[model samples]
Target: MKRLKQIVNELKLTQAAPEAALMREFIFYSPKMPLRLHQEQLVAASKQFSLEVFDTYFAHSDVTINCFSWGNGKRKVLLAHGWASKALDFYELIIELLKIDDLEIIAFDAPGNGSSISEFSNLMLYAGSVKSIALNYAQPDVLIGHSLGGMANVIALQELEITPHLLISIAPLIRLKENFEQSLDSVNIGAKHQDLFFDNFAKEFPVSASHFNLTNLYQLSTAIDHFLAFDPADHISPYSFLKEFLDKYPAIKSKSFEDVGHYKILRSLEVIDDVVKRIYALPML
Candidate 1:
């Protein structure tokens, strides 16, 4: 078994460079569906909440938005997804919050996930997408995001003036350390197995094997390629980018989940409920 593992690692190392390049491109393209099983589960959970969905275009990419229009509610809460995840990932939380007729909940599949255009070639592009969405949608009373979504929210909030009453960051990937950068550079899906990269991570991680399945393995591969190409350290620089954001907005309040990894943060029902209650409890502008 150990020998087999060694061989697999060697093979992956052998093809890392080419795969990383390909992965980078995939991130810029959009994601499609039959969708993942987890995605479907979230969608079904959201459906119970009387949420209405809207399809729009931004940066030449298609974007699908799901929102529950709370009657006479001026405040909007925008939920964002993480890397390699679709907007529907928030469906579990949406279902719970939509019960509060006073809270208008809005969530979107980021450019590459679900019904949104997938063209996040860089952080700036992602920030632009978020800005466009916020400007076009109801101004957010609060913005809540998990992992990559949180980073994107910071960028959008910094670049655009659509300030939310509060920000909730769940296991946010604030910055990629230099070590993590090199480690991510190690992921390799050869030409033949490229389609397995994105789906593989879900399977290998905490997600139940029965829960997550890709709609189109090809599209999943494309998404993985795009994500792998990025120098995460450069985009959401902890030293520079985050520092700049904090300097500009010194009092922006945020809550973080320390124990959860990138994706699992949203999978937990408890975490979702806690985040909702916290957001609801915060003082309004």
Candidate 2:
């Protein structure tokens, strides 16, 4: 994937969504390097916890997904990490959650991420993987997600047809259209595929591209104790639109951290403490 991207950039290949579907493939299955900073430490630390790591089949993606468990069955709290991130990325958060008595903490490696390998993946596939993790295995009492995983948690609430105890979104991707634009921009791919994306999006999803956002989460599920944590200066997740969305609907609880950016927010002690408090205060199911 890296070589394909590099070749496109160096050759200045004319970016287009041809009938060949190269553009669509690049847009959805883009590569990720989530473990570069603390790869060994994250895995090593996860091993120390004696996690009950296992695999389950994600039939839609035709992949056997990897999952991690910290405690026995109890008040289930499912964790979903963002794009390119693995289950163990939540190692610190898992440590904090394990302190809560009788809490069954579970997390999974989404397709094309960590141990769950696949050639195809998109927001739909990621969301489907999340739904499979919760509905097919651990039905979550509280759903907590970071980045893309956060958005998937909301999607899971809708698909599972259950009002979750609480949903925590940590710097989630707000708009899929904007997210695609940003991803391409970061790779210097320009906004050349905007038109093609919408055209392709229609075929990929029954609803319009606009439906894949936080705005619709309200209508999809009810009585969800939604909480959000973000950085005002986050470059990965669009902050301007997030602020706009927050302004339009002020009820969703939220907090901003200046010290930590997107990934670092996951490790912030302050953020972890706040999240643990919210977990402890979950509404009775």
Give lDDT for model 2.
0.71
What TM-score does each of the candidates earn?
A: 0.57, 0.82
Clashes of 1: 11
- Give the range where candidate 2 is weakest over 10 consecutive residues by summed lDDT: 47-56
In candidate 1, what are the lDDT values of residues 144-174, reduced to their tens digit? 7766666667667766654466666655554
lDDT of 2 by residue, 28-142 (tens): 5536555555545545544222112122222332555667676774788888888767787787788889788878887777776777666645666567767776656778888
Question: Which candidate has the top score in TM-score?
Answer: 2
lDDT of 1 at 172: 51
lDDT of each: 0.50, 0.71
